[model samples]
Target: MTMEIPIIEIKGVGPETAKDLEGLQIATVEDLFEHFPYRYENYEVRDLSTVKHDEKITVEGKVHSEPSLTFFNRKKSRLTVRVFIDRYLITAVIFNRSYLKKQLQIGETVTITGKWDQHRASIAVAEIKKGKEKRSRVIEPVYAVKGNVGVKQLRKIMSAAFAQYATQIVDALPEQLRTQYKLMDRVDALKAIHFPLDFRQVKQARRRLVYEELLLFQLRMQAFKMLQRREGKGSPIPVKKEDAASFISKLPFPLTQAQQRVMNEILSDLKKPYHMNRLLQGDVGSGKTVVAAIALFAVAKAGFQGALMVPTEILAEQHEVSLKALLEHEQVKVALLTSTVKGKRRRELTESLKNGEIDVLVGTHALIQDDVAFHNLGLVITDEQHRFGVVQRRTLSAKGNNPDVLHMTATPIPRTLAISAFGDMDVSTIDELPAGRKEIRTFWAKHDMLERVLTFVDAELQKGRQAYVICPLIEESDQLDVQNAIDVHGQLQHYFQKYNVGLMHGRLSPQEKEEVMVGFKENHTQILVSTTVVEVGVNVPNATVMVIYDAERFGLSQLHQLRGRVGRGSDQSYCVLIADAKSEVSQERMRIMTETGDGFKLSEHDLKLRGPGDFFGKKQSGLPEFKMADVVHDYRTLSVARDDAAALMHAEAFWKDDSYTALRHYLEQNGVFNKERLD
Candidate 1:
């Protein structure tokens, strides 16, 4: 393939237009080919008489009358055109698109796609083509354009580019793979994706491209895994079986079998010669911290220090309390170091940490500061691992000589995605909640049912139970109609006049947040109105009811986490999801939440409903975004890709086989073979 040809060479692209295309990353001919449509317009010919009201439809017709523009309001205008289709007249309305008035000429043939309005008997034009070309029913590609580049101009440019270079685009996948996966060739797939004659072609093209993308990603992950296995040795901290049992005996509660299994896995990893880079995945309220504390205790008993970095100050403080209580019998000194600790007290804690006087250090991002030195740091664990990136994790581990690093997350991801995203690390899941943990009964209600929900909350409070009123936004957003914590706090205070209401948001000072959380924890505040700030590790067993306002705005995993806050206690708990969601996707998300309390299932559902963006947050998941591949929808293909990559790698000789040369080169070009990433 002539991949290096510049996009500027394409017809209709001037210097200014090239700059606009560059904004969307269409630099070369290959990039233009890869610039898949964000969406498509269905331009299939349809009968106007059969069009449903408010349903988007496309039909070909001849302009029966000259277009006329009329002002509906001071700032709004509409362009109306009458068209004749099969001897029937239908009106097309172009609102705020008055510039099209001159283009809609009398007796001109055109094809238009828009919503059909049965009341006015008009078509609300969304898109229109000038000429009714002799083309079959097709889905027209809609490029993500900017500046002066309209969709029509971009389409013409893309058509010219494809004509000039389509045949030159060679298939990256080998013929054997293409046959094994039943994939269309690269050139055909690209052409069909950009300009498909039917939905069948779109499906074929998407399947082929999604498979290629997953195959490349799996290969890259496999390479990283191979590199990690060959990296430097780690500081080992082997523990005796009797010692581990003794450490567990000091716990306030017995560890669940799942927790015990994961702890054993961590212990075994520590005993290995190579460094331990493991992910500890557990659902909210699953007692992951207990297992983490056990691992830290083992490292401390082996005469080495451990550090646990969390995302929030309150969470860090909570962990400090829990760990101190759990390990005090062993005389392991636990220290808390956060940005809030200042003056001489901070210096004293730093000195203690440097001199090994502190056996375990738990804090927020403050643990990664340059001045924060450690004494024989053997294990480093980051709680709420998704909040921290790979570099941040590496910096903390760099504090020691290749310390055994354990990443802990309360948000559970599906097994396949976990394998895809964190293939570099070994994974252990604490699937079972601890014994005696009560499952929270979830309820879904619209805003109209708010009165009933508030009554239920009052009843729960009267029974000596606390409640949480979670709002989706910190402040009222001008764009979104979601409820805010501040406003909700004010309203709830007035509504529940007898109960104390507290407000919390991300904008609050650290001290302020701590004060509010402390108030809620001590039960002085009966109802805490807050944003998702308290979603992670704000454990209050006495809090038995969680009322989430505008719950439709939150992801399934977030909803699950919010529900976890209440179900921690043995007393019966309930999660009230107040959402007047109008979209089918939001309704489905709410329904799924009410049906099950499983975090893993919720996460899978969330991925399908919302894409991987909610889970990965764009680039932080440590994998580049695929142009066409969807992690949730194409998970089966992803597994197949992983299997194929493994098979190919195993068969290749010393990573230099002729069949693997193109794959290896692609990986290297994309920095998948970077030594630092491997390390």
Candidate 2:
């Protein structure tokens, strides 16, 4: 059998260009074929009357005036071209195209295709071709590009690559799956992705590719789970009901039904011999911390050390304080390990952990550093698991051999994403808040409400309460000139002369930031003005008010998290969202926040509004980008894929089924296959 040459073998693609293509992970001809467009440019010709303002359109008309050129700099120039159609003179601006001035001859007809900006009051032509004998207009494909690479160049190279390697690309998916799913062949799908025959072809091709990607991902997760179960190496920690019950009895408040259900699930997982990897999900002030404390107690009863990793130093300190209070009478030894504990204290803590003197260690990423080692570690828990990458979580867990991993997140994710991201782990959700917890009163206000909001904050402060005034930016930029944290802090200091104002942002050093946070947490500061750095793990019960400036700039999920900072205490908390955006999508997002306090529901709505890109910021998660699948829109497909994966794995015949070799290979190639497969 002769193997086909990779896409790099294509002519005219030098080493530099090939490296650029490889940045997108397109190395082989097959890789290139699988690389799909992020979006399509529909250059279908339309009439001038059909061209809406601020929408991309393709129109053909006669040039009514000579093109004019304006120079911004030596390297920068803009050209304006005018065309007359339907008795309307439509002008198009070609930015950085001084050459277009010579090409656009007066009284000549040309077809232009590009985006229309009403602010510039012109249609900017991304591509200008002379109107000649043309068969049909091509709907250009727009791929995700990297440094110095533009859509035009990518399209040209991809077209050439496809023409040469299209024949060699084979369908990796089995024929049965393709036929059952009504999917197109690999070659046709690739061509349609880059140069679709029509809109219907684009849709169908997209469906086929998304299904394949999601199906493979699901299969990989299933395989990992199966492999783990087969190994059966989990340490069984016998749960004593009295141990958990006694701890809960000491609590000031009764456990909600939701918390009890989650506790039961955790207890069950601990009793099993298989290693437990579970996520404890809950809303703010839902008492997930107490559930975690119970789990830690159960692990401690089994004479195994447990570790809890948080994202920030302040959070680790906060957890230490809370946990110490909860487990005061327990025989388990608890120790705090953060970057802040330095010199002799840090050394002593590390020594205690290594010597098994500490039964439970709580800290941030410092706990997973090379210098830190745990003695007889058996269980690991992470708060705000989304903030830590998969590799970071794995590293922390690896401190103990196959430690039962428990992750907690207040950022409620939709079921589809949760399964997709953490499919191998069992999930326990604490959906109910504790009794006497009040819903945070939320409102959308404009700039005019600033004085009123400030007055309310002052009133709250008079009651010996604290408030959070969050700004979107840390500093003014040309792109974003919204109110910054430092500027806001200074202004607030002047506005409320009697109240102490503290400031914090990402720009501040870790120590400086921690100091400011401590001040706010201790109520030494009446008002804390900050940026999104407070988005995760900053808990202050007395902070009854959250005022977010330019709320429209934030995504719905983020807005929800920021709003969650309030409403943690018994006080009637309020969240004020200030934005001038009246756009439908923006308004809808803000409306969802005002209408519901359900983080999971808000996440689902946010998924619908912002799509999967904003759901978890997929780019930051190191997950492969989807070309066409809207994680929200194709959730049904994802569910189907998940079910199919489960069924296929459960079947007794799967182990011996040769037909699944391609899929197995696909999973292995993507680095998602279980390590047991190598054996």
Candidate 3:
């Protein structure tokens, strides 16, 4: 097929220009075809007298005089022209468009769309095209330009690609669906999207392309689930209600209705024959861990091994302690393994795991190591799933034979993100807090209020409650003048001479971090100064105060997670943010944090504040990137596509049918056929 042909085939595109195309990710004909425009320019002529200053409007006119060009500011050039619109000769100023001077003659008609400069009685040219047709105004595609690749160059390349490879653009959506959806042809849509004849064509092209992209993605997700089902049914773990009742009875407090509901959903998945893929999401300290504990207990009660993988060693240790305490009476053997386990200890732990001596094994990425094996693994649970990518999650899942997977995240993801990122998995949320849990008293103070904050921390410490002092940076940086953990640790230690303040940061060894966290858990350390490394599942119920320096520098989600470090116990908790926020966004974030303790709401605010690209902050969440579909705004289309894909897959023998052959081939070509990375 010509789809994989290189980009050097264009008429004037030499080696250098072809290399520049790589900056736009256009190396192959397929890449060039998929390099969709970010926006379009509508050159429909409008009345000049109606629009106000600075409003973008299109005008039809003829050149009144020969255009003039002038050079300025390094290599910049400008072209000035007088266009006669109806009876009025209006001046048009175009920047860096020297080529326009040659084509514009004294009487040639032109269409100009730009911002109106009322005082100057002219239009600042945003786009100028040679056209006079009133009914068929050109809707020009605007590709994102970078490096040396300009709009003209990209347009030429796209035109050449369509001329040569239009026949190769196979319609992944079958004829049946195309007719049913009243969509445009695949080739027609591709051409009209780049060079549309009218507004109706652009609308049709966009709808066809958007639906195709979204449908293909949804098909991949559902196909993956179908393939997993065909592989084999998982070992069904029967729920023992009596044992669960006894376990709950031994707990110090009652489970919230939310937790009970999630537990019931998980238990339903466990007893099913097929492998269950579920996502458990909730606000931090909302009793997610206890609910996961109950599910882990059910897995062990079925006499099959379960592995619970977390992102950090401290979280692993914390889970280990909590699980052992909760499962002790039930005779469920729980074990911990991490990078710190080595030599004789490592060998013995792996051996015990292989022999099925451990009912639940908790650890960090170490659980996915090749040496770690299971005798009869049935259930796999991963905590803080965003910190681990699909590779790690699937690697751990591969250790078991068709194990039921439960992905837990304390950092609540917004519905837009959750639906798109985890659309394939069944989602269960623990929205309500447990009984006796108090709302964390949140306060935002300027840097000058540190003395009062310190006094409050001193009072909390005097009551034998520990505190956490969070700094944004681990080391002093010349770029940012924010507080570092080392400096804050020293200052706190000096201020509270009687209290033992331990230091922790990312640079410390895993064993050292474990030691510091253990000391804090044991009440030996009254305060721990650290970076965002403790932003995940570190449960120290004794810690009642979290003081974050330069809190405005952090995202609202991060601040919420840091606040979650406190308020784990029954006693009232507090979070102090010391920042003199100058930006409106930062000040708004502070206000939001002080106003509510809902992580999901804070995450939605964070999404709006930072947008989709910065929301995850370099973490992999297994979200598929779409060419034309915007998950934030096109969620309705996403839902429809999901339903269509599901309904199509649910049909009998759909994969083997000829009408669905193109879709199956697309799934294979798009890298969705890989089973290991499907999760």
* lDDT tens digits by residue: candidate 2, 1-679: 0124665688767788788878877776666656677677787777666566778877777888888999999999988888875576778778897987877888787878788765555687887777732535357677788865567777777778877766766566777778998899767887887788688988888888888778777787887887776664667777787888888897888999999999999988877777788998898778888999999987888778899999999999889988888775788788889877789988888898889888889999998898788877888999998788888998988788678888999888788777777788777888888877799999988888899989888899999999988999898778886888878988899999998999988989888998998899998998999998898867899999999999988988899899999887789999999887779998887888899998888988887887766677757643445655656778889898888888877876555567766666666665654334632
Better of 2 and 3 by TM-score: 3
Q: In model 3, how large is the Cα lDDT of residue 463?
A: 96
The candidate with the higher lDDT, 1 or 2, is: 1
Pairs of residues clashing in candidate 1: none
Candidate 3 at residue 250, lDDT?
80
Specify the highest-TM-score model's number.
3
- Global lDDT of each candidate: 0.85, 0.81, 0.85
**How does candidate 3 score on lDDT?**
0.85
TM-score of candidate 2 on Cα atoms, chains taken together:
0.76
Weakest 10 consecutive residues of candidate 3 by summed lDDT: 670-679
lDDT of 3 by residue, 128-243 (tens): 88867554435778899899999877988899878777887877787888999899988899898888888788888999888888888888788877767767587777878776
Model 2: how far residue 112 lies from native, Å: 13
lDDT of 2: 0.81
